[model samples]
Target chain A: MTQIYNFSAGPAVLPKEVLQQAAAEMLDWHGSGMSVMEMSHRGAEFMSILETALADLRELLAVPDNYKILFMQGGALAENAIIPMNLVGRKPQPATIDFVHTGSWTAKSINEAKKYANVRIAAAAPDGRFHAVPKRAGWNLHRDAAYLHVCTNETIDGVEYHFNPDAGDVPIVADMSSHILSRVIDVAKYGVIFAGAQKNIGPAGLTIVIVREDLLGHALPCCPSAFDWKIVAEHGSMYNTPPTYAIYIAGLVFQWLKRQGGVAAMEQRNIAKASLLYDYLDASAFYRNEIAKDSRSRMNVPFFLRDESLNEAFLVGAKAHGLLQLKGHKSVGGMRASLYNAMPIEGVQALVDYLKEFEQKYG
Target chain B: MTQIYNFSAGPAVLPKEVLQQAAAEMLDWHGSGMSVMEMSHRGAEFMSILETALADLRELLAVPDNYKILFMQGGALAENAIIPMNLVGRKPQPATIDFVHTGSWTAKSINEAKKYANVRIAAAAPDGRFHAVPKRAGWNLHRDAAYLHVCTNETIDGVEYHFNPDAGDVPIVADMSSHILSRVIDVAKYGVIFAGAQKNIGPAGLTIVIVREDLLGHALPCCPSAFDWKIVAEHGSMYNTPPTYAIYIAGLVFQWLKRQGGVAAMEQRNIAKASLLYDYLDASAFYRNEIAKDSRSRMNVPFFLRDESLNEAFLVGAKAHGLLQLKGHKSVGGMRASLYNAMPIEGVQALVDYLKEFEQKYG
Candidate 1:
C-alpha cells in the first residue's frame, strides 16, 4: 500500500494499527466465531467492550465523577437541536439560551436552539469571516439564561478557543467536535461537552456527550427519549441499539490513546504537528491561514494559496503525491489539512514539504 | 474457531461473506489506502459506497421510483419520535396519529408519538400478550389521523404481519427493524418503511428509512434538521456525516444478497428455516411457542420449555453446542432463535438438532 495521508476534515483518518486489529478481528472477535458487529448490545461480549471504552474515555479526559459520558448517534448537527431540547426544560417554559457565535457550528447551534428556546447571541466574532473568538469582556451574559453554548473548535472556519470561557453560575455547553481528545482540558469547567466522533474520535455515526449529572433529567416533553440525556445516561448510552461497530472502533482508539501515553502525550504531538504546518504557512507568502493566531485550530488548519487560480492544480498534485481530501469545506472554499490525533507528525512533514515544493513551482 | 451460529435479535448475525469482504478491505479500500471509516461522507470514495448501497437496497426491495431512501441514525427507537415529528405536520395542529398496538416496539412508538401529537390506538391485539396483529376489522383508525403506524415484525413477542393492512389514504408507516431483508415485501404498500440495520442489513447505528416523495416536507418545527426526511433526501443522507463504515458493510451485504439471487430466494430459505424449527417445537410436548401460528415471526421464534426451571441449563448446553444468543428478550423471558437473512439453513438445522438433543435429555 502507498504511504498515504488523508486530510478530510471529518469522517477522517484513523490510526492504522486500529484498522489492522479491527480487520484481524472482523470475522471472529476474540475467537468467538462472531464479528463484534454480530454481538447483541446487552450481551456479555459487547457490554464489556462498551464499559471499557467508557472507562478509558473517563481516564483520558479525566472526566469528573459527576459527569456522564453518553455515546449517541446523529452527530453534532443533531445535538445542536437535542442539547436545547434536553436542557431548556430546566428553566420555565420559553427559556432563553445564550450563545457565543464563533463560527459555523455555533451559528448553527443558535439557529437550532431557537426552535426549542429563545436563543440570545451573547457575543459574535467581529468579522463575518469568523477569524477569532470574541473576548469575554465583550460578552453580554444573560442572568437567567438556561445555558451558554460555544463551539470550542470550528472545523470549517479553523477557529478554536485556547481559553475556557467563564460563565460563572451559567453552565457552558461546548461543541468540541474537531478538537476533543487532541489536548487536555478541565472537564469540570463545562456543564456539557460534546464531540461528534468523526474528527478526533473514531467514526462519523457516534457522538459523545459528557454532561454533569445534575444537568440530566430536564428534557422537554418534545425531546425524543433516545436523545434525552437523562434517558440516555440512565441506560448507559443504550436507550437504543448504539452504533456498536463504531463504539468498538472507538474502544480500539481509546486503547491506542492509552498505549500512546494518554491525552497528555498526544497533546504534545498535536502541538508539534500543528506548529510545523502552521509555521510553514506563516513563513510562506505563497499561502495564508486567516484565523487569528491564538484562535487558530491545531486540529484543522484551513489555508489558501496566494495565487487563488492554483487551488484545483494544488489539490490534484497533492492527490498524486499520496495526499488526499485536501480540499477545504465548500463553505470556506480553500485548502485544509486536518492533523487529528490519528495524524502523525510525519504526515505533517509531508504536507509542509508539499507546500514548499508547490510554492517553489507556483510562487 | 468454533462454527458458531449467532441468533441475536438485533445487532444479530450478518452474512459471513460480508464480514470477510469488510475485513479484506478494512485497511486499503479498493487501493485507496483509506479504510471506509476514514473516508469523508462527502468525498467521492465514501459517496460512491453510499450511492451503491442505496442503489442495491432500492433494487433488492423493488422500491418504487416515487420513494426516497434515507440512511439515518438513532435506530427505529428514535424514529418513533422522528416519524411523528416529520409526519404530524402533514395534518392539522393537534393531529392524531393512529397506531395498531401490536407489541413492544409499537407501544414505544405510541408513547413517543404522543409528545408531538395525539396518539390513538387504532386497535390492540385483544390481549396484553400481543400474540397476533389485530385484524383490520377491529381497527378504529381516526378519520383524520396523520399516519397509521405498525410494527411489521414484533421482535420480542415473535408476532409478524405476514399480510399488509390497507390504510386507504392514511400513509402506513412500518417498523421493519427485525425482518427487513429476510423476506420480500411490496415497498409501495407503505408510505415509510424504516429498519434498524443491525438485524438483517449490516450493523447497528444505521437506520434505513424508505419514504414516498410525497411524504418529504412536513416536518414539525422541533424536528432536528438531520432527522428531517426532506433535508436528508436533499443532501443524499449527508445533511450530517453518516455512519460510513456501517454503510460500507451494508453495501457489502446488499451485494451478497444480490449474489444469492436477491430477496425472493432469501425469502424461500427463510421460510424453510422457520418451518424446520417450528415443526420440531409443534410436535414436542416438552416445548411450546405462544405466538399464534399465522402471526408467528419467521425471523424471531420465541419458544419455551415445559420445564421452565431448565431454561438456564438449556441456554448453557446450547452455548456449548456453539448456538449463540438464543435467550429471549428480558421482557418476555424464555428463549428466542432469531434466524435472520445471515443465518444459513445449516445454522437452523444445528439449532433444531440441539433442541432435539436437549429434549431427549430433559423431556
Candidate 2:
C-alpha cells in the first residue's frame, strides 16, 4: 500500500501517533472499561480528561489567568454570528463593529455582524483577490467600535497576519481556525480567539475559544445559552454535552505537541516546512503562489499552476503518487497544501517533490 | 474488569461492535489512507460516509421524504434556543409557543422558548415531581400558537410519553434525546424531532434534527445561519461543516443496528429490558421507581431505595459489580439505569440481581 500524505485544508492530516494511541484505547480509555465516548461528561473519568486538557492547553498557550478557555460547537462559522451577538451588547443597541476583511472568513464575520450590529470595514484586501493582509496604517479603526474583527489566517485566500494590530482600548477578535497552534502568538493580544478544531487541533465538531475574563457575560438576549461564552466558561464547557471524543483526541494531540516541545517548537518546524514549499514555488516557473511573502500562511499554502488547463492532470498525478486532497478550494481554483502542526516536514517535502515532478513532466 | 455496564444518561454507552469497528478504522477508513477525522468534508471519501449515514438513519426511522435530516452541533440544549429562533418567525410578532412541562428537559425548552416567543404552560406535571406525563386532555394548547413543545422522554425525571398529543393545525416539536432510537415511533407525528447523539445514537457533540419540509425557512433575523433549518436542509447539512467524525460513528452504529434488524427489533428488546427492571422495582419493598407506571421511561429508569441514606453504598456496590453511572441526577435523588438501545437485557438483569442482593442484605 502506498503511504499517503493528506493535504485537506481542514479535517486535515493528524499525527499518526495520536491516531494509533486513540485506536489502542478506543474500547477502554485508561482502564476505565469504557470508551471515552461512553463516559458521562460529569463522570470522574471524562472530567479528568477535560480538566487536564484545559490545563495543558493553558500551559501550552501561556494563557493569562484573566482569560477563560471555552470548548464550544457550531464551529467558527457559527461564531461569526455568535461573536457579535455576545460582544456588541457590551456597547449599546445596534453597536458598531469594525472589521478588517482579509479574506473569506473576515467577510463572513462582517456579514453576520450586520444582523446584530453596525459593521464598518476597517480595511479590506485589494479588490477581493485577497492576496495579502492590508497594511496596518491604512486600517480605519473606530475608538468607540464595540470590537474589531479579523480573520488572522484566511484558509481559502492563503493570507495571514504576522503581527497583531493595536486596537487601542477596543478588543481584537480573531478567527484563527486554520493557523491556531501551528505557530505561537501572545494569548493576551486578543479579547477573544476562536478556532474550529479541524486543522492543527483535532476534529470538526469541537471549537476551541480563548476569551479574556472581562469579555464574559455580555451576550445579547438572543444568544443561545449553550453558545454564550459566559455560560460555557461557568460550566467549564459542560453546559452542553461537549464533543467529548473530539476533546479527547485534541488532548492527545496536545500531549503530542508538548512532547514535541510545545507550540514554539512546532512553529519552528512549521516555518521550515512552509519555506520548503514556498521557496520551491518561487523558483519554479511552472507554479505560482499569489499571496504576498509577508502575509503567506504557514499552515495553509494555496498555489496555482501557470497553465490553468494542467490543474486536473496535476491533481490526478499527485494523488496517484501517494498525495491526497491537494486540489485548492473551488473558490480559488488551483491547489492548496495545508501544513498543520501534525503534518511532518517529510509530507511537505513529498508535496514539493510531487510539484517538481509534475512541473518537469509538463514544463 | 467485572464486565462493565455504563448507564450514563448522556455520553452514554454505545454498542461494543460499533466501537470495535471505529477503532479498527481509526487510522485509515476503507483504504482511503486517511482517518475519517482527516478527510475533507467535501471530499469524495467523507461525502460518501455522510451520505451513507444519512441514508441509514432515514431508513432506520422510515423518515418521510418531506423531512430533512440535519446533522448539527451543540446538542439538544443548544437546540432549545435554536428551535424557537427558527420557529417563532412562522407566526406573527410575539408568537405564543405552547409547552407541556413534563420534566427537566421540557422545562428547559419552555424557558429558552420564552426568550424568543410567549410561552404558555399548556400543562405542568403535578407538583413538579414529574411522576407522570400530564394527561393530554388537560393540556390547554392554543390554536394560534406557533408550535407546541414536548419532551417525549425526560432523562432526569425518567418520564416518557406513551402517546403523542393532538395539536390542531399546530406543529409538535419533540425532544427525544434520551429515547430516540430505543423504540419505534411515528416520525410523521411530529413536525420536528431532535435528539442529542449521546444516548441511543452514537456520541456527544452531534445533534440529529428531523424537520418537516414546511418548517425549513421561518428563521428570525437573530438565527445563526448554521442553525437555520432552511439553510441547513438546502445545503444538506453542510451549510457549515457537519460534525464529520461523529456522523461517521453514527453511520457505523446505524449499520450495526440494521445487522441487529433495525429499530423495530430494537424496540422489542428495549421493551424486554425496561420491563425486566421495572417489574423488579415494582415488586421490591426496598426499592421503588417513582414515575407512574404508564409514564415510566423505557430508556431511563430512575428509582430510589426505601432508605435514602443508602444511596452512596448502593452506588459503590453497583460500581464494584461493574455497573457504572448508576447514581441518578442530583435534581432527582436515588439511581438511574438507562436502558438505551445499546444497553442489552443482560445488563438490566445484572442490575435487578444487584437490587435483590442489596434488598436481602438491607431490608
Candidate 3:
C-alpha cells in the first residue's frame, strides 16, 4: 500500500501514533471493558482523561493561571455567536466590537457579531484580496470596543498573523482555528483564544476556549447556560455533558504531543515542512502562491496552477500518488496543502515531488 | 473475563458491532486512505457517510420529506436555548411557550426557555414528584403558545411519555435524548425532535435535530448561524464542521440497526428487557422502582433497593459482577439499568440475577 498523507484544512491529518493508539484501545480502554464512547462523562475514568488533557494543553500553550480552559462544542463557528453573547454583556447596551477582517473566518465572526453587538472593522486586508494580513499600525481600533477580534490564521486565504497586535486596554480575541498548536504561543497576550480541535489539536466536535478569568460571568441574558463561559468554567465544562470521546482522543493527542517534545518541537517540524513546499512553489513559475511571503500561513498553504486548465488533472495525479484532499476550499477555487502539526516532512516532500512532476508534465 | 453491561444514562452503551466496525476503520475508511476523523466535512467521503446516515435515520423514523435533518452540536441541553431562539421568532414579541414539566430534563428546558420567551407550565407531574408523566388532558395549554415542549424520555427521573401529546394546532417539540431510535415513532407529529447521539445513536459530540421544513428561516436575529436550522439545512449541516467521525460511527449504528430488523424489532427487544427487570423489582420485597408503571422508561429503569443503608454495598457488588455504571444520577439516589437498544437481553438478565442474589444476602 502506498503511504498516504491527508491535507484537509481542518479535520486534517492527525499523528499516526495517535490513530494507532485509539484503534488499539477502541473496544476496551486499558482493560476497562468499555470503549471511551461508553464511559460516563462524570465517571472517574473520563474525568482523569479530561483533567490530563486540560493540564497538558495548558502546559503546551504555556497558558497563564488566570485563563480558564473550556472544552466546548460547535467548533469555532459557533463560538462566533457565543463569544459575543458572553463578552458584550460586560459593556453597555449595543457594545461595539472591533474586528480585523483578515479573511473568511474573521469575516464570518464579524457577521455573527453583528447579531449581538455593533461591529467595527478596525482593519481589513488591503484591496479586498485576502492575500495578506493588514499591518496592525494601520488598524483604527476603537478605544472602548468590547474586544478586538482577529483570525490569527485563515485557512481559506492562506494568511496568518506573525505578530500579536497591541489592542490597548480592549481584550484581543483570536480565532486560531487552523494554526493553534502548530507553534508555541504566548497565551497571556490574548484575552481569549479559541480553536476548533480538528486542525492541530484532535478531532472535529471538541473546541478549546481559553479565556481570562476576569472575563467570566458577564454573559448576555440570552446566552445559553451551557455556552455561558462563566457557567462552563464554574462547572469545569461539564455544565452539559461534554464531547467525552472527542476529549479522550484529544488527551491521547496531547500525550503524543508531549512524547514528540511538545509544541516547541512540533513548531520546528512544521516550519521545515511548510518551508519545503513554499520554497518549491516560489521557485516554480508553473505554480503561484498568491499570499505575501510575510503573511503566508505555515499551516495552510494555498496555491494555484499557473495554467488554471490543469486543475482537475493536477488533483487526479496528486491522488494517484497518495496525496489526498489537496483540493483547496471551494470558496478559494485552487489547491491548498495544510501542513498541520501531524503532517510530516516526508509528506511535504512527496507533495513537492508531485508538484514538480505535474509541472513537468504540463509546464 | 466477565461480560460487561454499561448502563450510563447519556454517554451510554453502544452496539458492540458498531464499536468494532469503527475500530476496523480507524486508520482508513473504505480504501479512502483517511480515517473519518481526517476527512473534511465537505469531502466526498464524509458527504457519503452523512447522506447515508441521514437516509437511514429518516427511514428508521419514517421521517417525511418535508422534514430537514440537521447534524448539530452542544447536545440537547444547548438545544434548550437554540430551540427558543429559532422558534420564538415565529410569534410576536414576548411570545409564550408552553411546557409540560415532566422531570429534570424538562425543568432544565423550561429554565433555558425563560431566557428567550415567556415560559408557561402547561402541566406538571402530579404531586411535584417526577414519578409519572403529567396527564395531557389536564394541561392548561395556551392557544397562542409558540411550541409545546416535552421530554419524551427523562434520563435521570426514569419517566417516559407513552403517548404523544395532541397539541391541537400547536407543534410539539421533544427532547428524545436518551431513547431516540429505541422505538418506532411518527416523525410528522413533532415540529422538532432533537437528540444527543451518545445514548442510542452514536457518540457524545454529535446531535441530531429533525425539524419540520417550515420551522426553518424563522430564527431570531440572536440565533447563531451554526445553530440556525435554515442555514444548517441549506448547507446539509456543512455550514459548520459537523462531528464527522461521530457521524460516521452513527452511520455504522444505523447500518447495524437495519440488520437488527430496524427500530420495530429493537423496540420489542427493549420491551422484553425492561419487563425482565421491572417484573423482578415488583415481585421482590428487597427492591422498588419509583416510577409509575405506565410512565416507566423502557430505556432507563431507575430503581431503589428497599434498604437505603445497603446502597454502597449494592453498587460495589454490581460492579464486581461487571454491571458497570449502574449508579443512578446524583439527583436521584438509586440504581439505574439503562436497557438502550444496544443492550442485549442477556445483560438485563445478568442485572436481574445480581438483584436476586443481593436481595437473598441482604434482604
Best by DockQ: 2
In model 2, chain B matches the true chain B with a TM-score of: 0.99
Q: Tell me what TM-score chain A of model 2 achieves.
A: 0.99
User: By TM-score, how accurate is candidate 3?
Assistant: 0.99
Query: Candidate 1, which segments miss by more than 4 Å at Cα?
Result: none
Candidate 2 segments exceeding 4 Å error? none
**How badly does each model clash, as a count of residue pairs?**
0, 0, 0
- The true-versus-predicted C-alpha distance at residue A88 of model 2, in Å, is 0.3
Off by over 4 Å in 3: none
Q: List the residue pairs that clash in candidate 3.
A: none
Clashing pairs in 2: none
> Which lDDT tens digits does candidate 2 get at residues A73-110?
99988999999888988997879999998888887878
Ranking 1 against 2 by DockQ, winner: 2
Worst 10 residues of 2 chain B by lDDT: B106-115
